[model samples]
Target: MVASLLSARGLNKQFHSGNQPVSVLSNLSLSLEQGESLALTGRSGSGKSTLISILCGLEQPDSGRLTVLGEAFDGDAGRQTEARWASLRRQQIGVVFQEANLMPALSLLDNVRLRVRLAGQDEDGCRDWLERLGIGELAARYPDQVSGGQRQRAALAMVFAMKPALILADEPTGSLDRHTAEDVTGQLFDLQARYGCGLILATHDIELATRCNHHLDLGHQPEA
Candidate 1:
């Protein structure tokens, strides 16, 4: 049987404020299968970002069992675990942050090329991904030279180029205007359908959340 794309059980996290600990996530658990899309809906400070961080292995959960693509991590931050997560991020996982995380020094095309190389994908298709996102003309521009929406699109192009088994997107359209956001949102869905990858995205837009295959509200605040 094919392994599940992602699984988290009894995940917990907290943040320290002065001397007091603020609860963020309490015994949170989620699962995803290939070709599935899950939307995380919650207000600000509701641990949406915190959960995303933990899911991507950027932050360690206080306690939990996490299995991604058959590799398991159980509250242990060993070197081998770190190495495994790093490898997964490089190859099987695609992360799209709220703010486009692009290399300032490289042109958009080159950045996508780098991601494809790191992900062990075909670099020849990198520019094609940019073209599909309506940023082909700006491929030669540096991240700083492009507008915020354009830069975000380039970041998305990098993700699409990698063709990862799982995608984690955080507030993907947070900065764009309604029209642009909708455009980008459509492209995101297109990526999922065409690639048949599992997608987990955090968003405050109820309309967006409803479009996903599953909705998971953190419940720290009113649902979006």
Candidate 2:
């Protein structure tokens, strides 16, 4: 049998509010295969972003096991595993958090080119990716020059240019208008399908969530 592209088992995470502990994710388990997509839906504070952070190794779960692209990490990964996760992020994992983390000094096009170069992908297609996302005209603009939604699209363009094997998108369309959101979302799925990459999308948009192959609702989490 083929191993999953990403897997998490018995994951648990919590935070402390000065003294009281607040449970976030409780014994969550999930598996994702290449070419599959998983949607995470819940109200705010329902652990959507938390889950995304954990999946990409930005934040570690209090206790659990996580495997991505064949690299395994225990919940208490700490700083020792950052290099491994960083390598995967540069070449195999693409993350699009709500905040478009674009460099202040780089033009949109340069951001995409940088990502492609880091991933060892051809930079020639960077502009094409931006065009497909409807942001080609703004390629020369800095992040501050564009609207929030446009910056988000630019971020998406960077991710696509990298052609990562796995994508973690947290409200990728949150900043766009309805029409722009539709256009961006279409491109997101199209590229993901063409590349056969695994996707884990965290969104409050029911319509967007329905597009994924699997759905998990944190509001009604299973008992651990």
Candidate 3:
């Protein structure tokens, strides 16, 4: 078997909602290898987003172990981890959030080119990704000027341009119309295959999950 590019062992996350402790993920474990794609499905409040947050290092687990490319996730050294993850994510991990999350002031090209700049990548890499994602024509348009579908496409371009090792998307199509959602999802998978990036997506769409290599029902866990 191929080595896993990312892994989580004994993953658990808990939060305080008033005086009660809400356990989100309990004893959950998952792994993904390069070029693999897995879809995670769970109903609302099933900890799907929480899990994604932890995996992306956006939030720390109360207790668990996370390893990316053999390196541990160190929240204590988050600045360092962010820098390293930012670099690795730039080189390997692509993320597509539910919202396009574009800056209204920036042009589509600049928005897509943001990570390339952060990663210190070259213009060729940025331009190539924009073209591949079918947004080269709108490169000069500002985010606010574009349609919702176009904005999502631009966001995908930005993430793809990073050429990350893994791609983590949280309900990337949730806000789109069926047609646009399908288009975005199609592009996401196409890029995943093309780039050989491991994909771990948290989605409520069952049909989307079926298209992946493996599917897991996170809501079925005994406790959450």
Candidate 4:
């Protein structure tokens, strides 16, 4: 049988708003196979980020079972060590945040090289990845010197350079204009397909969500 790249079951999460507890996720479950793309859509406060955080090991669910690349984390297993999660983030998972994911102090090329190095990948092709993302000429520029769209392109180059098994992108183009968003997301999908990596993208854009192989709307029940 082909092993799933990521799997989660019966996820539950809660948070306190003032004195009342709000249930953000209840018995949520999802899975991603290699080379598949899953889009997560929901309202602003819908637990989309929370779910991604849990999946990426940034946060633990109150109760659930998570398995990524064959490594398991049972909710009953208690809190996992930082090292364990760090190892996964470094080697198997590549995450792109909505903004400021690049190191402001480093030049674009250096940032990609650093990320690739951390993933234990060769840094030689870092420049090629940046060029593929359409930011090659800006390799020597710092993050603050580039436009928001360019910076995001650099971030994508960094993520793809690592050749991660699973990619979790949160609002990757939320700050860009319509045209730029389309351009960036188009490259994202194309590169993802070329790499044959699993992708889970959380976005508020309905049209963008539709491009993925599957869609999960947190506003309603998840589709089977």
Candidate 5:
């Protein structure tokens, strides 16, 4: 059996709006093994983004627990130390977001190779990933210089170059047209399979969710 790469138990999150508390996630539980792909589907404002953030250790839940790649996170100073290992997670974990979120100052190639530079690896190989993703020609271009689909594609290439063990994506194709979205989505799944990384994508796109091996529908659950 493939080893479990990530696990969450009783995952809960809440926020306070003025005098009242708004619950975001309640006892949400999930697990992912190496090379697995899970798609999260839900309506808007259903705590999907909150859950994703918590899973990535970007936000702390009011209560609950999470473990990633065998290490536990408690949201304490010790866990802060552990979370500093987020760099390690970044090195080994790819993240694709709806906006592409590339820096305006860097060229496409420079953006993709930035992680490589940070890890002291050869940046030349970034060219191959760009070529594979069919964004090679755009390498010389800046983020604002490209179309939305192209920018997202460039972002994927950047994360792909990392060869992460797990990938957490939130509506990666949300900004693209249908055809372009499908194109980018196909490339992402292909790379995920090729690299044997766990993929957990949060999206409301049914077509996108259908492409994954497994699906988790957050819309059916009661609001937290």
Candidate 6:
């Protein structure tokens, strides 16, 4: 049988606003296989980001079981150590945020190199990734010197350079213009397919969600 890349069961999360507790995620569960893409679609504040955070080990669910690349975490077992989660993120997961994902101090090439090095990948090919993403000319520029689209391209180069087993992109193109968003999305899907990695993209764009192998709407009823 083909092994799953990621899995979650009975996931539940809640937060407090003043004296009231609001449920963010309730009995949420899903899975992703290698080379498969799952688009998570939901309205804003519908637990999309929260789910991504939990999947990437950035936050713990109040109750659930999550397994990623053979690493398992259950509510009964408590949260994993910060060091452990950090290591997992550094080596196995690549996250692309809407903005501020790049290191402001480093040049674009250096940022990609750093991520590649962290994943035990060769740093020499970092430039190749940028070139593939059509940002080779901006390799030496700082994040602030580039346009939003170029910065996002650099982010993609960094993520792809890391050679992560799984990628979690939360509204990766949310801040870009429609044309720019489409370009970035195309490159993202192409590289994801070429790398044979698992991807979980959280966004409200229905057209974008339809491109993925599967789509899960968090606004709908959670599986029993």
lDDT, each prediction: 0.90, 0.90, 0.82, 0.90, 0.83, 0.91
What lDDT would candidate 1 get against the real structure?
0.90
TM-score of each: 0.96, 0.94, 0.92, 0.95, 0.93, 0.96
TM-score, candidate number 6: 0.96
Question: Candidate 2: global Cα-lDDT?
Answer: 0.90
Better structure of 2 and 3 per lDDT: 2
Q: Identify the candidate with maximal lDDT.
A: 6
Total backbone collisions for each predicted model:
0, 0, 4, 0, 0, 0
Q: In model 4, which regions exceed 4 Å deviation?
A: 76-80, 222-224
Across residues 150-223, which tens digit of lDDT does each residue of candidate 5 receive? 99999898888877788899999988999999999999999999989899999999878888888888767554
Model 2, residue 212: displacement in angstroms? 0.5
- Of 4 and 6, which scores higher on lDDT? 6
Q: Kindly list the per-residue Cα lDDT of model 3 for residues 27-129, writing each as its tens digit.
A: 8888888888889998899888888878877778877788987778844555787776656666666777888988888898888777767756675777677
Candidate 6 lDDT at 149 equals: 94
lDDT of 6 by residue, 49-120 (tens): 999999988888999898888888875433355566788899989999998488899999999998888888
Which stretches of model 2 miss by more than 4 angstroms?
1-3, 76-79
The residue-by-residue lDDT of candidate 2 on 1-224, one tens digit each, is 54489999999999998999999999999999989999999999999999999998888898999999999998545566998988998998999987788998999999999888999999999999889888899999999999888888888899978988899999988877889778778888998999888899999998888999999998889989
RMSD of each: 2.4, 1.6, 2.0, 2.0, 1.9, 1.5
Runs off by more than 4 Å, candidate 3: 74-83, 222-224
Score candidate 4 by lDDT. 0.90
Question: Ten-residue segment with the worst summed lDDT in candidate 3?
Answer: 74-83
